[model samples]
Target: MKGLFLDAVDELAAVFRHVARPGDPPMDVIERGEIRPEELPGLIAGYDFILDDHTALPTEAMRACAGLKHVIFLGTGARSYMNPEELADLGITVHTIKGYGDTAVAEHTIALMWAAARGLACMDAGMREGMWLRTEGVELTGKTIGLLGFGGIAAEVARIASGSGMRVLAWNRSPKAAPGVTFVDLDTLLAESHVLSVHLLLNDETRGFLSAERLAKLRPGAILVNTARAALVDKTAMLDALRSGHLRHAALDVFLTEPLPAGHVLTTLPNVTLSAHSAFRTPEASEKLLRMALDIACGL
Candidate 1:
């Protein structure tokens, strides 16, 4: 079977070339930024499967791509780009890679948490603009941090936060246990945490999980951090909380919209810190991600 690595941006094509084995399935790497849903049918013609990085493959458009049997998504958040169930009904199995960037993403989550706690971004931006801004910072040495979900990434985050002398509390949809991490009910997690870091995966049940009602439960002046899916929180409620000083600050690595539009309300918020959904971006993670994708293609 043949394969195509679709949407290999940010030098991923080079990484694919470096990790690909001689005996692996023959795959073509397309070094482009993004491909529209309408382009999928044509671009995937004659290819048995495609390795999608970040493309929108609407079910209607994918239905036209005859004989395309599989989609090897480069990341676990495949639902953000396509409806896997809809494609499954059309005989296209969508496969997602996980654990490839767990450590990389966890480290980034810690970075954002610290940055928000200390107002590092605001100070840096102010200094660059010829102003010396010094804001009061939150000391996390003995603070409580809540993890919304328990998973591979959250596990790594727990280790780092625990080692830094912060108390770790976690609430998962199901039961979980970790050394030095307390498993608590959602209500307890929300009310007691000084820093709330979201790690829940997005789905029908988890989308908007942190609604206005839930946001109201959080301790006032608590810092919010999300390196997981953006849809997990109510963006409107989050903005309102920030504006009213209900939340001390929010450090976000993911968003409701990618490449958040210019003049976006988030850019104007003094209490917001934004990263380009790049928590999982690192040389080590990139190499491991491509190697894992290639392994999936070989099995296909």
Candidate 2:
């Protein structure tokens, strides 16, 4: 099967060339930026498979790509870009790479947690605007941190946090075992943690899983670190929580909209720190992810 590395944005295209090898399938790179949902069918026609990094593939639009049968998503959260089950009905088997960037994302999550706790971003922004902002920050050591899910990334986070002397608490939909981590009930985890790091995947059941009611359950003044999909938390409720000081701060790597619009409300919030959906971006992780996508295409 021929494959197209759809939407080869510079960053991904750069690393993709570095990892692609001689034995790989005939995969063409579309040296364009992100493809919109409406452009999917037109741009993807003629390709039997696509190794997509961050393009939308709506079932309705994708139906127009008559010959396409496979989509090897470069990362785990393909659901944020399209419905795999719906695509499956169209004879398109969506494949995702797992464990490719666990350490990269885990390190980003830990970095966000520390930055939020210490108000680093806020201070940096203030200083850049000619203001000397000196704000007291949260001390993380010996504090309880809650992990909303137990996955490969969370396991790495548990390892790092545990090593740093912070009590790690986790709650997953299924049972899990990790060293130096305490598994707790959702409510217990919510009420006890001083810092809550989100790690749940985005899906029908998980969209806005951290709703207003659930957000209300968090320990007062808790810090929130979200490197996971943005829809996992109720965006509006998160804003209110940050404004009211119910949440001490929120450090996010993902947003409901990519390239979060300039002058967006979140950008204006002093208590929020933002990173361009780059939590899983590291040289090692990018190489592994692209290599894995190539492996899936080769198999197909």
Candidate 3:
């Protein structure tokens, strides 16, 4: 079977080569800077499988690629790129990798939280510009952290927060328990937590899960952190709350629109810290991601 690695960004390609085995189907890497939906059909013309990192394979494009049978998405949030159900209807099996970068992402979440709480990024930027800005930050000790979803990433966050002397409370779609963590209802988690971290997967039910009404339930001046898909939170609502000072700050690694268009409102806010959706990035996580993708591709 012929396979194409569409949008194989650098560094990751090196890791992919290391894990790819001999005797496997020939794989081609297209080193383009970006792939848009309109370019999908021509780019994937006759490949039996495509390994996509962040490119979109819209249903219309998938229908045009007559030979494409499998999509080995490099991460778990394949829905953000292509709808699995829609592709499945076209006889294309969408495979996603999970548990490959849980610890890496969790560590990043903690890093963002600390950065937001301490104004680390702003301070660093100011210092680089010859200005020394020291902003007072809230202490995390004895504070309550709310986990929006209790999955692998959230579990890891719970572990780290607990070790740091912060009380952890989580609200999953279903019940879950972990040492030194309490499982609470959504309202309780919102009303009580001083810091709220979102880790839910994006789906119909979870899309816009943190709406304006729900966000208002959070304690005034609460900190918000999301390493999950940005669509989970209503962007307008979040901006309003931040502008009103209802939310103390936000540490965001993902945005509804990636590469977040220049001059986006979120960029202008002082209380918001932005990361380029790189929370899951690390040497260790990169290796695991490549190995897992290759395993899935080879299995097919």
Candidate 4:
């Protein structure tokens, strides 16, 4: 069946076109920048499938898309943008792609970890203001790093960090076995890790998973790197912890709000470094992602 590539940004649309080999399902591209929740039904009209990226499809609005049957979301965090079960009840199956950007994201995670450790962002900001900033950096070798969730991305991060001479630790809801990575309980991971990287998926149970109480348990002055969903942690508590210096730094790629509003509190904090949710934006990853999305669309 043919599909609509909704919210196709210029770069991603280019990737889709480059990867369009013969025999894939026909898909129309709409290079619309940012769609509101209220505008979804009309935009999605008459398509048998939708290739979605960064749009919230509220059930009420999606109920009006008469011919829609499938949504091939470009990333694994489909839950953050739409409720799969609710959409399924309306005969629209939400499908997400994973493992497409494991390396890209893992490399970004490592870079963020290094940047935070040495106050690289702070120094860069100072440099931009005509100041000669010589900031002391963190020596990552021999330091302990904790992975809050173990998945492909985390595994890649573990591989890179372990090779670079850091002690690696991981805690997952399900049991996992990775070479050179120590598996530990939540409290033990919290108490012992020098750098904690969050990789949990967002859902009802995982929403606000890192609460104030749990944040309190973390070893004070530890660095936090969250490439996962921002809803997984309590924003206010995280801000408080940063202000109080309980958290040495936070390198974030995801946020409670996308394009995190100007003058947001996180922006005001010097200890926090932000990326516009771009951990998975490399060309290799984008090519793989579109190829997978096309595969899902063809299957429908």
Candidate 5:
């Protein structure tokens, strides 16, 4: 089937070419920056399927594309950009790739956890501004880290944290087991964990899962690391927790808005560490992701 790689930035375009095989389905890559939802119909006119990377595909806009049958989202968080159920009603199937960047994202989760625990970003910014900032750092060796969801990414995170001598606790919606990890109920996980890392998928059931009441259950002074979706936690509640120092710190990779606006409240917070949702941008992960996307297209 003819396909288009919609919204492939230059870096992604390069990776796509690197992983393309000779016998693969015909696919064209559109090397451009972000496109508006209104531009969707024109760009995907004759494509049977499209490989989407961080683009918004409104059902209304997609309705105009008559021949499109499938959308192979480059990552698992397709719900952040489009309503899969709505698209399905339009006769379009949405496919998501998993485990492509598990290691990359897991390593990033650990890095953010450490950075927040140690106040690294605050000190770094202070140093850049001609001040010698020496902040007390948390020693993670004996800390307890709770994984909110047990998935491939969280499994890798549990392994790393366990190797570092940290106690690992996980709570998943369904039953799951992993070595060196203790499976606990949500309340126990919240009350005992010194560090809490969110790894849940964003969906109707899980959106704003960490509400004000739930955030209140966290151990006072606990650090939070989220490489998962932003909507998973209540934004106002998180801000209140951070501002009130109920939460020791928060390290975030995703946000309610992309390109988090200049002078945003989050940017102004000293207890917060922010990354541009780049936990899965490593070269190894990029190569694996594109290769897997191509593999999925072959199956389609």
Candidate 6:
């Protein structure tokens, strides 16, 4: 089968080579800095499968690609890139890999939580400019951290937080159990947590789940961390809370808009720490993602 890797930026060529065996499939890379919907068709015309990292495959483009039957997305956020049901109607099955970067993302989430609580980013910037700044950071020990969803990444977060002597609490749409973790109702979790981390998937039911009213229910001076999709939270409400000091700080790895645009309001906020949606970006996760993609393609 013929495969095309669209938007293969960040030195992923070696990963594809490592995962793909000779004679299994012929793959080509189009290393464009950015991909628009208009350029997708010509770039992936004759390929039977397309591997997309962040390119959006709209319904119109998928319908135009007659030879395309499969799309192997790099991560589980395919819905953010393309509508899976719409692509399936056009004979393209979108495949996503989960749990490949669970530990990688969980570790990054913990790092961001620590950074936000301690004002590490701002202090580091001041020190680099030859100014000594000492900021008092909140203690994590004996504090309550609430997980919004209990998935693989959340489980890993719970493990780490519990090990650090922080109390772990979680709320899920369905029931779940982990040793020493408390499962509470949504309202209870919101009012009681010192740190709240979002781990829910983005879908029709969960988009904007953290609305303005819900944001108001959070404990005063609470720290919020989101390593999940940005759509899960109301962007305007979150910004307002951060600016009003209702929320002490936010460590965000995802945004409503990817690349976040230059000079966005979130960029100017002193209380917000932003990552370029790179929580899942580790060498080990990259290898696992490539291997899983190759396995899916080979199975097909």
- Model 6 lDDT per residue over 195-226, tens place: 99999999999999999999999999999999
Clashes of each: 0, 0, 0, 0, 0, 0
Off by over 4 Å in 4: none
- lDDT tens string, model 4, 24-63? 9878999987888788888878779999988888899998
Q: Model 1 segments beyond 4 Å from truth? A: none
Report the C-alpha lDDT of model 3 over 1-300, residue by residue, as the tens digit: 899999878577878787788967789998775888788888898899988888878898778888899999999999998889999999999999999999999999999999999998888888999998998998999999999999999999999999999999999998788888899999999999999999999999999999999999999999999999999999899999999999999999998888899999988898999999999999899899888887777778
Tens digit of per-residue lDDT, candidate 1, span 16-81:
898889989998878888688788888999999999988889989999999899999999999999
lDDT of each: 0.94, 0.91, 0.91, 0.92, 0.95, 0.91
TM-score for candidate 2: 0.97
lDDT of 5 by residue, 52-82 (tens): 9999999999999999999999999999999
**TM-scores vs. true structure, each candidate:** 0.99, 0.97, 0.97, 0.98, 0.99, 0.97
Q: Model 3 Cα displacement at 221 (Å)? A: 1.1
Which run of 10 residues does model 1 get worst, by summed lDDT? 33-42
Clashes of 2: 0
Model 6 has how many clashing residue pairs? 0
Query: Which residue ranges in model 5 land beyond 4 Å of their true spot?
Result: none
Q: Whose lDDT is greatest here?
A: 5
